[model samples]
Target: MGSEGAAADRLLSWDRVSLVIGLLLLIVGHYQGLFVAPAEAMMGDVGRILYVHVPTAWACMLVYTACFVFAGLALWSGKGKWDAAMEASAEVGVLYNALLLIQGSLWARPTWGVFWTWDPRLTTSAIVLVLFVGVLVLRRVITEPERRLNLGSIAAVLAYAGVPIVYFSVKWWRTLHQPFSSPATVSDSFITPLRLAAFGMIFLGIGLIGLRWRALRREVERELSAPALPAALPTLELGQRGPGGAA
Candidate 1:
Protein backbone atom coordinates (compact mmCIF):
# COMPACT_ATOMS: atom_id res chain seq x y z
CA MET A 1 0.00 0.00 0.00
CA GLY A 2 1.25 3.46 -0.90
CA SER A 3 0.37 7.00 0.22
CA GLU A 4 -2.41 7.17 -2.36
CA GLY A 5 -3.94 4.01 -0.94
CA ALA A 6 -3.66 5.44 2.58
CA ALA A 7 -5.43 8.62 1.46
CA ALA A 8 -8.26 6.65 -0.09
CA ASP A 9 -8.67 4.71 3.15
CA ARG A 10 -8.97 7.95 5.12
CA LEU A 11 -11.65 9.20 2.75
CA LEU A 12 -13.48 5.92 3.17
CA SER A 13 -13.34 6.36 6.94
CA TRP A 14 -14.70 9.89 6.61
CA ASP A 15 -17.58 8.60 4.51
CA ARG A 16 -18.50 5.96 7.13
CA VAL A 17 -18.52 8.53 9.90
CA SER A 18 -20.77 10.82 7.87
CA LEU A 19 -23.20 8.02 7.08
CA VAL A 20 -23.57 6.92 10.72
CA ILE A 21 -23.94 10.40 12.16
CA GLY A 22 -26.43 11.38 9.47
CA LEU A 23 -28.72 8.36 9.98
CA LEU A 24 -28.70 8.85 13.75
CA LEU A 25 -29.74 12.48 13.46
CA LEU A 26 -32.42 11.69 10.85
CA ILE A 27 -34.10 9.09 13.08
CA VAL A 28 -33.92 11.26 16.16
CA GLY A 29 -35.29 14.31 14.39
CA HIS A 30 -38.04 12.44 12.58
CA TYR A 31 -39.32 11.01 15.84
CA GLN A 32 -39.43 14.42 17.52
CA GLY A 33 -40.96 16.19 14.51
CA LEU A 34 -43.71 13.63 13.91
CA PHE A 35 -44.59 12.56 17.45
CA VAL A 36 -43.38 15.23 19.82
CA ALA A 37 -44.22 18.48 18.06
CA PRO A 38 -47.56 19.86 19.10
CA ALA A 39 -50.42 20.05 16.62
CA GLU A 40 -50.99 23.40 14.94
CA ALA A 41 -54.01 25.65 15.37
CA MET A 42 -54.96 26.12 11.70
CA MET A 43 -53.61 23.20 9.68
CA GLY A 44 -54.45 20.65 12.38
CA ASP A 45 -52.96 17.19 11.80
CA VAL A 46 -51.96 18.23 8.31
CA GLY A 47 -49.49 20.72 9.70
CA ARG A 48 -47.33 17.78 10.76
CA ILE A 49 -46.62 17.51 7.09
CA LEU A 50 -44.01 20.15 7.70
CA TYR A 51 -41.58 17.59 9.14
CA VAL A 52 -41.76 15.42 6.04
CA HIS A 53 -42.02 18.07 3.34
CA VAL A 54 -39.32 20.38 4.60
CA PRO A 55 -36.69 17.76 5.29
CA THR A 56 -37.13 15.97 1.98
CA ALA A 57 -37.00 19.24 0.09
CA TRP A 58 -33.84 20.15 1.92
CA ALA A 59 -32.27 16.83 1.10
CA CYS A 60 -33.30 17.06 -2.52
CA MET A 61 -31.54 20.34 -3.00
CA LEU A 62 -28.55 19.22 -0.97
CA VAL A 63 -28.08 16.14 -3.11
CA TYR A 64 -28.39 18.05 -6.38
CA THR A 65 -25.81 20.55 -5.24
CA ALA A 66 -23.49 17.68 -4.41
CA CYS A 67 -24.07 16.08 -7.78
CA PHE A 68 -23.24 19.36 -9.45
CA VAL A 69 -20.06 19.65 -7.41
CA PHE A 70 -18.92 16.22 -8.48
CA ALA A 71 -19.87 16.94 -12.06
CA GLY A 72 -17.76 20.04 -12.02
CA LEU A 73 -14.85 18.04 -10.66
CA ALA A 74 -15.25 15.47 -13.43
CA LEU A 75 -15.33 18.10 -16.14
CA TRP A 76 -12.57 20.20 -14.67
CA SER A 77 -10.12 17.35 -14.22
CA GLY A 78 -11.47 15.14 -17.03
CA LYS A 79 -11.65 12.09 -14.79
CA GLY A 80 -14.09 9.21 -15.26
CA LYS A 81 -14.04 8.50 -11.51
CA TRP A 82 -15.62 11.87 -10.74
CA ASP A 83 -18.12 11.19 -13.50
CA ALA A 84 -19.29 8.10 -11.63
CA ALA A 85 -19.63 10.10 -8.45
CA MET A 86 -21.76 12.67 -10.26
CA GLU A 87 -24.02 10.02 -11.76
CA ALA A 88 -24.46 8.25 -8.42
CA SER A 89 -25.35 11.43 -6.55
CA ALA A 90 -27.77 12.50 -9.28
CA GLU A 91 -29.62 9.17 -9.02
CA VAL A 92 -30.15 9.63 -5.29
CA GLY A 93 -30.95 13.33 -5.70
CA VAL A 94 -33.63 12.58 -8.26
CA LEU A 95 -35.16 10.04 -5.88
CA TYR A 96 -35.28 12.61 -3.10
CA ASN A 97 -36.87 15.11 -5.51
CA ALA A 98 -39.52 12.58 -6.51
CA LEU A 99 -40.32 11.99 -2.87
CA LEU A 100 -40.61 15.74 -2.39
CA LEU A 101 -43.11 15.97 -5.22
CA ILE A 102 -45.26 13.11 -3.90
CA GLN A 103 -45.22 14.32 -0.32
CA GLY A 104 -45.95 17.87 -1.41
CA SER A 105 -48.90 16.71 -3.49
CA LEU A 106 -50.27 14.65 -0.62
CA TRP A 107 -50.03 17.62 1.72
CA ALA A 108 -51.60 19.84 -0.92
CA ARG A 109 -54.73 17.74 -1.36
CA PRO A 110 -55.81 18.14 2.25
CA THR A 111 -54.93 21.84 2.52
CA TRP A 112 -55.62 23.04 -1.02
CA GLY A 113 -58.51 20.73 -1.91
CA VAL A 114 -56.71 19.32 -4.98
CA PHE A 115 -54.10 16.63 -5.44
CA TRP A 116 -52.13 18.67 -7.95
CA THR A 117 -51.75 22.35 -8.78
CA TRP A 118 -49.38 24.51 -10.84
CA ASP A 119 -47.69 26.27 -8.01
CA PRO A 120 -44.24 27.57 -8.96
CA ARG A 121 -42.44 25.40 -6.42
CA LEU A 122 -44.23 22.27 -7.58
CA THR A 123 -43.84 23.08 -11.27
CA THR A 124 -40.16 23.86 -10.95
CA SER A 125 -39.60 20.74 -8.92
CA ALA A 126 -41.19 18.65 -11.62
CA ILE A 127 -38.91 20.26 -14.16
CA VAL A 128 -35.92 19.48 -11.98
CA LEU A 129 -36.86 15.82 -11.95
CA VAL A 130 -37.35 15.63 -15.71
CA LEU A 131 -34.07 17.41 -16.34
CA PHE A 132 -31.99 14.98 -14.27
CA VAL A 133 -33.90 12.01 -15.60
CA GLY A 134 -32.72 13.17 -19.00
CA VAL A 135 -29.21 13.25 -17.63
CA LEU A 136 -29.41 9.62 -16.55
CA VAL A 137 -30.91 8.57 -19.84
CA LEU A 138 -28.31 10.47 -21.79
CA ARG A 139 -25.58 8.72 -19.87
CA ARG A 140 -26.82 5.40 -21.23
CA VAL A 141 -26.97 6.39 -24.91
CA ILE A 142 -23.27 7.24 -25.14
CA THR A 143 -21.02 4.20 -25.16
CA GLU A 144 -17.72 6.07 -25.08
CA PRO A 145 -16.61 6.85 -21.56
CA GLU A 146 -15.15 10.32 -22.22
CA ARG A 147 -18.09 11.48 -24.30
CA ARG A 148 -20.51 10.23 -21.69
CA LEU A 149 -18.68 12.17 -19.01
CA ASN A 150 -18.76 15.44 -20.96
CA LEU A 151 -22.44 15.07 -21.72
CA GLY A 152 -23.22 14.24 -18.12
CA SER A 153 -21.31 17.28 -16.92
CA ILE A 154 -23.25 19.56 -19.22
CA ALA A 155 -26.54 18.09 -18.10
CA ALA A 156 -25.64 18.50 -14.44
CA VAL A 157 -24.81 22.19 -14.75
CA LEU A 158 -27.93 22.91 -16.78
CA ALA A 159 -30.24 21.04 -14.42
CA TYR A 160 -28.68 22.50 -11.31
CA ALA A 161 -29.29 26.01 -12.62
CA GLY A 162 -32.99 25.41 -11.91
CA VAL A 163 -32.50 24.51 -8.28
CA PRO A 164 -32.37 28.04 -6.89
CA ILE A 165 -35.42 28.91 -8.96
CA VAL A 166 -37.36 26.04 -7.44
CA TYR A 167 -36.30 26.88 -3.91
CA PHE A 168 -37.12 30.56 -4.23
CA SER A 169 -40.04 30.43 -6.65
CA VAL A 170 -42.43 30.75 -3.75
CA LYS A 171 -40.57 33.73 -2.44
CA TRP A 172 -39.80 35.40 -5.80
CA TRP A 173 -43.32 34.97 -7.07
CA ARG A 174 -46.43 35.16 -4.90
CA THR A 175 -47.78 31.63 -4.66
CA LEU A 176 -50.33 29.47 -2.88
CA HIS A 177 -47.71 27.31 -1.22
CA GLN A 178 -46.42 28.73 2.04
CA PRO A 179 -42.92 30.16 2.11
CA PHE A 180 -40.32 27.88 3.69
CA SER A 181 -39.88 28.33 7.43
CA SER A 182 -37.23 26.52 9.38
CA PRO A 183 -35.56 27.82 12.58
CA ALA A 184 -35.76 31.30 11.11
CA THR A 185 -39.51 31.04 10.42
CA VAL A 186 -40.83 31.09 13.99
CA SER A 187 -40.05 32.31 17.45
CA ASP A 188 -42.69 30.90 19.75
CA SER A 189 -42.95 27.33 21.11
CA PHE A 190 -41.75 25.69 17.92
CA ILE A 191 -38.00 25.95 17.59
CA THR A 192 -36.49 22.84 19.11
CA PRO A 193 -36.90 19.61 17.16
CA LEU A 194 -37.93 21.19 13.89
CA ARG A 195 -34.59 22.94 13.77
CA LEU A 196 -32.91 19.69 14.65
CA ALA A 197 -34.83 17.99 11.83
CA ALA A 198 -33.65 20.50 9.28
CA PHE A 199 -30.05 20.04 10.34
CA GLY A 200 -30.63 16.34 10.57
CA MET A 201 -31.68 16.12 6.95
CA ILE A 202 -28.62 18.12 6.00
CA PHE A 203 -26.27 15.69 7.70
CA LEU A 204 -28.23 12.70 6.47
CA GLY A 205 -27.96 13.85 2.85
CA ILE A 206 -24.22 14.37 3.30
CA GLY A 207 -23.77 10.88 4.66
CA LEU A 208 -25.85 9.22 1.96
CA ILE A 209 -23.90 11.04 -0.74
CA GLY A 210 -20.58 10.00 0.76
CA LEU A 211 -21.56 6.36 0.87
CA ARG A 212 -22.88 6.37 -2.68
CA TRP A 213 -19.90 8.34 -3.94
CA ARG A 214 -17.34 5.89 -2.56
CA ALA A 215 -19.25 2.93 -3.88
CA LEU A 216 -19.55 4.46 -7.32
CA ARG A 217 -15.89 5.42 -7.29
CA ARG A 218 -14.99 1.78 -6.81
CA GLU A 219 -17.32 0.75 -9.62
CA VAL A 220 -15.66 3.17 -12.03
CA GLU A 221 -12.24 2.00 -10.90
CA ARG A 222 -13.23 -1.60 -11.56
CA GLU A 223 -14.52 -0.77 -15.00
CA LEU A 224 -11.23 0.98 -15.72
CA SER A 225 -9.13 -1.89 -14.39
CA ALA A 226 -11.20 -4.82 -15.57
CA PRO A 227 -9.70 -7.13 -18.17
CA ALA A 228 -11.30 -6.74 -21.58
CA LEU A 229 -14.15 -9.17 -22.03
CA PRO A 230 -13.77 -11.92 -24.62
CA ALA A 231 -16.15 -10.26 -27.05
CA ALA A 232 -19.04 -8.55 -25.27
CA LEU A 233 -17.31 -5.37 -24.11
CA PRO A 234 -17.39 -2.43 -26.53
CA THR A 235 -14.03 -1.13 -27.67
CA LEU A 236 -14.53 2.35 -26.20
CA GLU A 237 -10.88 2.61 -25.40
CA LEU A 238 -9.89 5.55 -23.13
CA GLY A 239 -6.23 6.49 -23.16
CA GLN A 240 -3.80 8.53 -21.05
CA ARG A 241 -2.30 11.40 -23.06
CA GLY A 242 0.02 14.38 -22.39
CA PRO A 243 0.66 13.08 -18.84
CA GLY A 244 0.13 9.97 -16.69
CA GLY A 245 -3.69 9.50 -16.50
CA ALA A 246 -5.30 12.81 -15.44
CA ALA A 247 -3.70 15.36 -13.16
Candidate 2:
Protein backbone atom coordinates (compact mmCIF):
# COMPACT_ATOMS: atom_id res chain seq x y z
CA MET A 1 0.00 0.00 0.00
CA GLY A 2 2.79 2.42 0.85
CA SER A 3 4.60 1.70 -2.39
CA GLU A 4 1.41 2.08 -4.40
CA GLY A 5 0.69 5.44 -2.78
CA ALA A 6 4.20 6.64 -3.50
CA ALA A 7 3.85 5.60 -7.11
CA ALA A 8 0.59 7.51 -7.37
CA ASP A 9 2.23 10.59 -5.92
CA ARG A 10 5.06 10.36 -8.41
CA LEU A 11 2.56 10.17 -11.25
CA LEU A 12 0.73 13.22 -9.94
CA SER A 13 3.97 15.16 -9.78
CA TRP A 14 4.64 14.44 -13.41
CA ASP A 15 1.16 15.64 -14.31
CA ARG A 16 1.75 18.89 -12.48
CA VAL A 17 5.02 19.37 -14.28
CA SER A 18 3.37 18.93 -17.65
CA LEU A 19 0.71 21.44 -16.71
CA VAL A 20 3.26 24.07 -15.68
CA ILE A 21 5.28 23.67 -18.85
CA GLY A 22 2.16 23.89 -20.96
CA LEU A 23 1.00 27.06 -19.19
CA LEU A 24 4.34 28.73 -19.73
CA LEU A 25 4.39 27.83 -23.40
CA LEU A 26 0.84 29.08 -23.89
CA ILE A 27 1.72 32.41 -22.26
CA VAL A 28 4.67 32.91 -24.56
CA GLY A 29 2.75 31.85 -27.66
CA HIS A 30 -0.23 34.10 -26.98
CA TYR A 31 2.03 37.05 -26.28
CA GLN A 32 3.85 36.60 -29.58
CA GLY A 33 0.59 36.18 -31.45
CA LEU A 34 -1.00 39.30 -29.94
CA PHE A 35 1.98 41.61 -30.22
CA VAL A 36 4.64 40.25 -32.55
CA ALA A 37 2.70 38.63 -35.39
CA PRO A 38 1.52 41.02 -38.05
CA ALA A 39 -2.21 41.51 -38.66
CA GLU A 40 -3.81 39.81 -41.65
CA ALA A 41 -4.44 41.96 -44.72
CA MET A 42 -8.07 40.84 -44.82
CA MET A 43 -9.22 39.75 -41.33
CA GLY A 44 -6.75 42.11 -39.60
CA ASP A 45 -6.31 41.50 -35.85
CA VAL A 46 -9.29 39.20 -35.69
CA GLY A 47 -7.24 36.42 -37.29
CA ARG A 48 -5.22 36.30 -34.09
CA ILE A 49 -7.97 34.18 -32.62
CA LEU A 50 -6.61 31.27 -34.63
CA TYR A 51 -3.61 31.12 -32.33
CA VAL A 52 -5.76 29.71 -29.56
CA HIS A 53 -8.61 28.39 -31.68
CA VAL A 54 -6.53 26.19 -33.93
CA PRO A 55 -4.58 24.78 -31.02
CA THR A 56 -7.79 23.97 -29.17
CA ALA A 57 -9.20 22.23 -32.22
CA TRP A 58 -6.07 20.13 -32.57
CA ALA A 59 -6.01 19.17 -28.92
CA CYS A 60 -9.69 18.34 -28.83
CA MET A 61 -9.35 15.86 -31.70
CA LEU A 62 -6.20 14.34 -30.26
CA VAL A 63 -7.83 13.86 -26.87
CA TYR A 64 -10.81 12.12 -28.39
CA THR A 65 -8.43 9.91 -30.34
CA ALA A 66 -6.75 8.99 -27.06
CA CYS A 67 -10.14 8.27 -25.52
CA PHE A 68 -10.89 5.87 -28.35
CA VAL A 69 -7.61 4.05 -27.85
CA PHE A 70 -8.14 3.85 -24.10
CA ALA A 71 -11.64 2.47 -24.61
CA GLY A 72 -10.31 -0.29 -26.79
CA LEU A 73 -7.63 -1.16 -24.26
CA ALA A 74 -10.16 -1.20 -21.42
CA LEU A 75 -12.36 -3.57 -23.39
CA TRP A 76 -9.49 -5.90 -24.21
CA SER A 77 -7.58 -5.92 -20.92
CA GLY A 78 -10.32 -5.11 -18.41
CA LYS A 79 -7.80 -2.97 -16.54
CA GLY A 80 -8.73 -0.17 -14.18
CA LYS A 81 -6.12 2.22 -15.55
CA TRP A 82 -7.38 2.00 -19.11
CA ASP A 83 -10.96 2.45 -17.96
CA ALA A 84 -10.00 5.47 -15.91
CA ALA A 85 -8.03 6.91 -18.82
CA MET A 86 -10.94 6.52 -21.18
CA GLU A 87 -13.22 8.40 -18.82
CA ALA A 88 -10.65 11.10 -18.23
CA SER A 89 -9.93 11.67 -21.89
CA ALA A 90 -13.62 11.76 -22.72
CA GLU A 91 -14.23 14.43 -20.08
CA VAL A 92 -11.30 16.52 -21.26
CA GLY A 93 -12.36 16.06 -24.86
CA VAL A 94 -15.78 17.41 -23.98
CA LEU A 95 -14.24 20.45 -22.34
CA TYR A 96 -12.00 21.17 -25.32
CA ASN A 97 -14.88 20.56 -27.68
CA ALA A 98 -16.96 23.16 -25.86
CA LEU A 99 -14.12 25.63 -26.03
CA LEU A 100 -13.60 24.92 -29.72
CA LEU A 101 -17.20 25.74 -30.49
CA ILE A 102 -17.17 28.95 -28.49
CA GLN A 103 -13.96 30.10 -30.06
CA GLY A 104 -15.19 29.26 -33.54
CA SER A 105 -18.37 31.19 -32.91
CA LEU A 106 -16.47 34.22 -31.73
CA TRP A 107 -14.30 34.15 -34.82
CA ALA A 108 -17.28 33.38 -37.01
CA ARG A 109 -19.43 36.29 -35.89
CA PRO A 110 -16.94 38.73 -37.33
CA THR A 111 -15.70 36.79 -40.37
CA TRP A 112 -18.85 35.07 -41.49
CA GLY A 113 -21.31 37.68 -40.26
CA VAL A 114 -23.09 35.07 -38.13
CA PHE A 115 -22.47 33.19 -34.94
CA TRP A 116 -23.11 29.78 -36.50
CA THR A 117 -24.13 27.85 -39.58
CA TRP A 118 -24.62 24.25 -40.62
CA ASP A 119 -21.24 24.04 -42.25
CA PRO A 120 -20.02 20.46 -42.49
CA ARG A 121 -17.08 21.00 -40.15
CA LEU A 122 -19.16 22.72 -37.50
CA THR A 123 -21.98 20.17 -37.75
CA THR A 124 -19.66 17.20 -37.38
CA SER A 125 -17.78 18.83 -34.53
CA ALA A 126 -21.03 19.44 -32.64
CA ILE A 127 -22.08 15.84 -33.19
CA VAL A 128 -18.77 14.63 -31.80
CA LEU A 129 -19.34 16.65 -28.63
CA VAL A 130 -22.85 15.28 -28.14
CA LEU A 131 -21.72 11.71 -28.68
CA PHE A 132 -19.04 11.91 -25.99
CA VAL A 133 -21.36 13.72 -23.63
CA GLY A 134 -23.70 10.75 -24.05
CA VAL A 135 -20.86 8.45 -23.03
CA LEU A 136 -20.47 10.41 -19.77
CA VAL A 137 -24.22 10.37 -19.17
CA LEU A 138 -24.36 6.63 -19.68
CA ARG A 139 -21.56 6.06 -17.21
CA ARG A 140 -23.42 8.08 -14.57
CA VAL A 141 -26.72 6.24 -15.03
CA ILE A 142 -25.16 2.81 -14.53
CA THR A 143 -24.24 1.82 -10.96
CA GLU A 144 -22.23 -1.36 -11.37
CA PRO A 145 -18.57 -0.55 -11.89
CA GLU A 146 -17.65 -3.30 -14.30
CA ARG A 147 -20.88 -2.92 -16.19
CA ARG A 148 -20.42 0.82 -16.34
CA LEU A 149 -16.90 0.43 -17.67
CA ASN A 150 -17.95 -2.04 -20.33
CA LEU A 151 -20.88 0.00 -21.59
CA GLY A 152 -19.06 3.29 -21.33
CA SER A 153 -16.13 1.88 -23.23
CA ILE A 154 -18.45 0.74 -25.93
CA ALA A 155 -20.10 4.16 -26.04
CA ALA A 156 -16.74 5.87 -26.28
CA VAL A 157 -15.71 3.66 -29.15
CA LEU A 158 -18.89 4.54 -31.00
CA ALA A 159 -18.50 8.21 -30.25
CA TYR A 160 -15.04 8.19 -31.77
CA ALA A 161 -16.52 7.41 -35.16
CA GLY A 162 -17.53 11.04 -35.37
CA VAL A 163 -14.03 12.40 -34.82
CA PRO A 164 -12.66 11.36 -38.18
CA ILE A 165 -15.70 12.76 -39.89
CA VAL A 166 -15.13 16.03 -38.12
CA TYR A 167 -11.56 16.14 -39.29
CA PHE A 168 -12.29 15.31 -42.91
CA SER A 169 -15.54 17.18 -43.32
CA VAL A 170 -14.00 20.34 -44.67
CA LYS A 171 -12.10 18.38 -47.26
CA TRP A 172 -15.02 16.19 -48.26
CA TRP A 173 -17.55 18.96 -48.71
CA ARG A 174 -17.95 22.59 -49.60
CA THR A 175 -17.98 24.75 -46.50
CA LEU A 176 -17.26 28.13 -45.02
CA HIS A 177 -14.57 26.60 -42.83
CA GLN A 178 -11.02 26.60 -44.21
CA PRO A 179 -8.97 23.53 -44.97
CA PHE A 180 -6.17 22.36 -42.70
CA SER A 181 -3.42 24.98 -42.38
CA SER A 182 0.15 24.11 -43.29
CA PRO A 183 3.56 25.75 -43.87
CA ALA A 184 2.85 25.84 -47.58
CA THR A 185 -0.40 27.75 -47.12
CA VAL A 186 0.11 29.86 -43.99
CA SER A 187 2.60 32.71 -43.71
CA ASP A 188 6.02 32.05 -42.13
CA SER A 189 5.30 34.61 -39.41
CA PHE A 190 2.25 32.71 -38.13
CA ILE A 191 3.85 29.27 -37.88
CA THR A 192 5.95 29.79 -34.77
CA PRO A 193 3.17 30.92 -32.47
CA LEU A 194 0.73 28.42 -33.95
CA ARG A 195 3.12 25.55 -33.31
CA LEU A 196 3.86 26.80 -29.81
CA ALA A 197 0.19 27.07 -28.92
CA ALA A 198 -0.58 23.69 -30.46
CA PHE A 199 2.08 21.94 -28.46
CA GLY A 200 1.07 23.84 -25.35
CA MET A 201 -2.51 22.69 -25.69
CA ILE A 202 -1.37 19.12 -26.21
CA PHE A 203 0.76 19.07 -23.08
CA LEU A 204 -1.87 20.84 -21.03
CA GLY A 205 -4.45 18.30 -22.13
CA ILE A 206 -2.13 15.47 -21.16
CA GLY A 207 -1.72 16.94 -17.69
CA LEU A 208 -5.45 17.40 -17.23
CA ILE A 209 -6.14 13.86 -18.39
CA GLY A 210 -3.48 12.46 -16.11
CA LEU A 211 -4.81 14.22 -13.04
CA ARG A 212 -8.35 13.14 -13.75
CA TRP A 213 -7.18 9.62 -14.49
CA ARG A 214 -5.52 9.37 -11.09
CA ALA A 215 -8.70 10.26 -9.26
CA LEU A 216 -10.76 7.88 -11.38
CA ARG A 217 -8.22 5.06 -10.98
CA ARG A 218 -8.48 5.37 -7.19
CA GLU A 219 -12.27 5.18 -7.44
CA VAL A 220 -12.05 2.10 -9.63
CA GLU A 221 -9.61 0.43 -7.28
CA ARG A 222 -11.78 1.13 -4.27
CA GLU A 223 -14.88 -0.23 -5.95
CA LEU A 224 -13.10 -3.37 -7.06
CA SER A 225 -11.49 -3.95 -3.68
CA ALA A 226 -14.55 -3.43 -1.52
CA PRO A 227 -15.93 -6.53 0.17
CA ALA A 228 -19.29 -7.71 -1.01
CA LEU A 229 -22.15 -7.09 1.37
CA PRO A 230 -23.46 -10.12 3.24
CA ALA A 231 -26.59 -11.60 1.81
CA ALA A 232 -29.76 -10.22 3.40
CA LEU A 233 -31.26 -12.40 6.12
CA PRO A 234 -34.31 -14.27 4.91
CA THR A 235 -37.54 -12.59 5.98
CA LEU A 236 -39.98 -14.54 8.19
CA GLU A 237 -43.57 -14.98 7.12
CA LEU A 238 -46.26 -13.37 9.33
CA GLY A 239 -47.33 -16.74 10.82
CA GLN A 240 -43.81 -18.21 10.86
CA ARG A 241 -42.10 -18.42 14.20
CA GLY A 242 -38.53 -17.43 14.92
CA PRO A 243 -35.93 -20.16 15.12
CA GLY A 244 -36.27 -20.46 18.93
CA GLY A 245 -40.06 -19.84 19.10
CA ALA A 246 -42.50 -22.65 20.08
CA ALA A 247 -44.17 -24.42 17.17
Question: Which candidate number would show the highest lDDT if scored against the true structure?
Answer: 2
Worst ten-residue run, lDDT, model 2?
A: 238-247
Report the Cα lDDT for residue 45, model 2.
Answer: 98
lDDT tens string, model 2, 1-247?
7787797787458778888888888999999989999997789999999899989988998999999999999999887789999999999999999999999889889998999866666667788889999999999999898898899999999878766766576546655556666657899899889889988999999999988998898888677565888877765556665454423
- Over the stretch 1-247, how does candidate 1's per-residue lDDT look in tens digits? 2675576678457667776776777677778767877877789878877877777887788788889998999899877678888988898888888988999889889988988877777777888899999999998898777788898889899889877766576545745665557667665545666666667767767776666776777766666454765765444535653333431
Q: Cα miss at 41, model 2 (Å)? A: 2.1
Please give the distance, in angstroms, between residue 91's alpha carbon in candidate 2 and its true position after superposition. Answer: 0.4
Best by TM-score: 2
Query: What's the distance in Å from true for residue 123, model 1?
Result: 1.5
Candidate 2: residue 125 lDDT (0-100)? 78
Report the alpha-carbon TM-score of model 2 versus the true structure. Answer: 0.86
